[model samples]
Target: MKELTKQQSKVLACVEVYLNKTGFPPTRAEICKELGFKSPNAAEMHLRALEKKGYISIQSGSSRGISIVKSQQAFEKNVNQMPVIGLVAAGSPTLAEENIEKRIPCDPSMFSDSFDYFLKVKGLSMIDAGIHEDDLVAIKKTIDVKNGDLVVVRLEDEVTLKYFKKNNHNLELIPANKDFSTIEVDLREQEAFIEGKSVGLIRTH
Candidate 1:
């Protein structure tokens, strides 16, 4: 295998990251904007170098036509793949096997800790935290959490993402946005369990 130059390695990393997030290769203009290149020609040159080194396949005259070659295995070893479970409502298990939609590959080194899985956010309740609808939120599997920590909670049969708060005998699931009401569950009457803590988030433009 041929070793990559610094610029070629950076371009390859960008391509892999884009492919993992969007399931498609980025355009030359997109690469230029991402790498702060003055022009698309710079991005083109880097892409050509990557292809020449057998790291990627580039289809001419096609937008977003780049594809990873067999050499990508080296890069794959550095990433962590996690399942993207479907939307968790207000009363169910977020990690239910049936709710698993697909798996997403991401660079775990970008985060401070290891994550158990990814959840596709489905509402505006956490918009203030920069978590929007359809964003992929990385969750760490742990029930040990502190007050005001964003967590995935199972309230009866439903599940929700909110800031957790314990008040004497009650549990409060606070939403980041004021438009959404805070959920207060009486621990004596209903069971509220912490599913996991949100560690990081991924959004695609």
Candidate 2:
């Protein structure tokens, strides 16, 4: 797989999460919201980059034409033909499989170089991070992250996503919502685990 820049990787991960949750794809505005970008154009630029990098395929003028490439085997299975599902959102992961519309043909080569797995996004605590209610934030599993990186952290047995920041000798798990207070942990008090870093958002609605 090709190496992804920090920004590119984050956007891509968000996309995966949205897909797994809603079984659909996200719009550019939705992408901007989840990734903390000001303009949808930023999302569009990265998407184009994702397309150029062979991690995604975009159908111009269509909002639901985005698809991720899972494996080379699947890509080879259908050279120019693949499957397109219905519009997908990234908030809830517990939808009935029956809700899935028929699959349309697509190209897997579009997303051949991105990471694996999709995370279903829930809740709106991450709105400042652009993760709104029902947005699916795609994530790439990796233990590696620098201080202050936006991460999916399981704290106190609850799974929450936030930026990993440090203050003095304690670590700060900061939420995006102003209504929510930041979490401070003594390095010796307990352990904060990192599940993965976010890549992209797949908004369905």
Candidate 3:
């Protein structure tokens, strides 16, 4: 099984504790109250990371959607092919047919974590972080990821890659290069969704 980072472990523990106490998984709001997070989004970020690591499985369309995997074998990656997404359009899903540049046979074990698809890097906002133009980044689709992780995010249908940092009700999309400025989003007013976390990068150039 892939080792979880310190924060990831804490989130897992939080989920376990809530399950033991309430006889069901905790809602994101409950996690915020327990974990001292300023917003539900913070709790969600950690939950998504836990789910991606295979320690838990999240049932969509539920407020308290977390469930334990309970088996090491559940962590095994079995992806067959990975879709390469390019230029995601507004109001379109990330993996929409028109956005898919190509499909490549990708070995599951090639990356540290299981990925949903590859997003072709288009710009230099994260150049200092070693991600360059035309790089194919392994993206694990999730809304919640640890702060400072490289994240693919969508704001009002515009997709971009940046370091994610959340504080209270405001989240910052930080650029790695000096040429670019960090984008600040107010969760109260602006809706920014985290599309995925970058687990690996494939550079052909």
Candidate 4:
């Protein structure tokens, strides 16, 4: 494959992330918004360049018809295959056999540590950290986490992503967004426990 320009590389990464998250390509307008392009035409131009470079295939006249060429996957063979876990009921394991929705391909080198799975973010709690709704958060499975770490925690059966902070008395789950209130769990009474630490994020347009 030919080298991609910086802007073209951003566009290609956006498309690849979106495809890995949703199993389909993004629309031109989506690409424009994601890359901060002034117009969809700019996105179209980048897509054309990507196609010319043999990175992606565009289906003429079809909306959201972009597809990554199979050869591209060959280059990403070292990428990790992580399960995208869905809902976790209170008292159940975070990656229980029944909670897995599907597995998605992730670039392992994106993080320093290997990830156990991906969790589909569902709310605006972590928006200040640029984590948006529907984003895939890569989680390294571990119970050992420190203060100020972005972690996946289970309170009883409910699971959430928050900045972890703990003291002698209680655990604080801090939300990045000001609109949401911080969660406080009593260390002695609650069933709260760290499931994993968030190592990376994959945002789709």
> Which candidate wins on TM-score?
3
lDDT of 4 by residue, 1-205 (tens): 3667888888988888777778788999998888888799999999999999866789999989887752323234324545677535455345654576665665566678777778888888999999988888888889999999999988877889999999987899999999999999888887687888988887777
TM-score of each: 0.58, 0.45, 0.59, 0.57
The per-model lDDT (C-alpha) reads: 0.80, 0.63, 0.79, 0.79
Q: List the residue pairs that clash in candidate 1.
A: 90-158, 90-159, 91-157, 91-158, 91-159, 92-157, 92-158, 92-159
Off by over 4 Å in 4: 1-79, 87-93
Error of 1 at 36 (Å): 56
lDDT of 3 by residue, 1-205 (tens): 4567777777777777778677888898888888788898988888788788666899999878787763222223323456788745464345654566765666755888878888888888899999888899898888769898999888897888899999999899999999999999999999987888999989775
Better model by lDDT, 1 or 3?
Answer: 1
For model 4, the run of ten residues with the poorest summed lDDT:
70-79
Residue 104 C-alpha lDDT in model 3: 66
Q: By lDDT, highest first, what's the ranking?
A: 1, 4, 3, 2
Q: What are the per-residue Cα lDDT tens digits for candidate 1 across 91-166?
A: 5545544565765666555679778778889889999988999998888889999998889988777778899999
